[model samples]
Target: MRTYQLYLIDDEFASHYFGKERMVYQLFKDYKEAVGEYKKILEKQIDFILKPIQEIKIHQFISQYLQKNKDFYTNNGLYYLEIGKRSTAKLEIHERCLMLKANGNYEAETIFFEVLRKTESSFIAIDLEHQRCGWLKPIKERKFV
Candidate 1:
């Protein structure tokens, strides 16, 4: 039987569901590797995951990030957060959120809202904000299969 893993990436929150523990490790390796893999998957499957979003919405999302963080932007609206800068990088906020999700360290709803609030508040506080940015919007509670 072909095995599939379900990975959830909501703003910052991310989770993976697998029938086997070993498989999860193989696919994700660790939180950092998993985030990198998720980015690759998102790029490769952009058409599919982004299908529900209108072109303008997609553009707006990418544009906002570009405007907010310039150096990280690459062509084609893809922004990469460098590894050494992960701690304070706005892009890595979502990665930290994902790490929290993977470890079950935070409540999904709370973490989602907190990340949003912090991002917005931090943006407002600084004359020029330089940090990783992403948020988790609330969703229906998920139960692992």
Candidate 2:
């Protein structure tokens, strides 16, 4: 199944669904499209606030990343954050990726890159953003039955 999620760019930025929804980034077709439209609002800014969203293809087993530090994929706000806190990073899942939100949105890709730094070329991490099908493994290892 293909769905959309949002990782707030700033940790201090009041999360829209925090507490009420620990994982506020729900998985649904409408939410996905809504996020796409929301992303546009952030794009209009000349300076930019939210981090670029990474496309996670849970069904296809494919994932996307920023590829560069502080680099993002779109101006759209949905893929990014709502811009409540302009200078924080939140929502990084990987243990090594943990950092103060004062830095910026601690996103999945951040963890992905962090993992790459700590592990061998073969190590891999399943984008936990998927919720149901997420794990970290090495490229050389095959655990799937």
Work out how many backbone clashes candidate 1 has.
6
Top-TM-score candidate index: 1
lDDT of the structure predicted as candidate 1? 0.30
Please list the Cα RMSD from the true structure of every candidate, rounded to 1 decimal place. Answer: 13.8, 17.2
Write model 1 residue lDDT over 40-127, tens digit each, in one string.
7745542232112133433354455444543334344332322233221222222112221111222322322343343332111111
Error of 1 at 128 (Å): 36
Per-candidate TM vs. native?
Answer: 0.26, 0.21
Angstrom error of the Cα, residue 37, model 1: value is 28
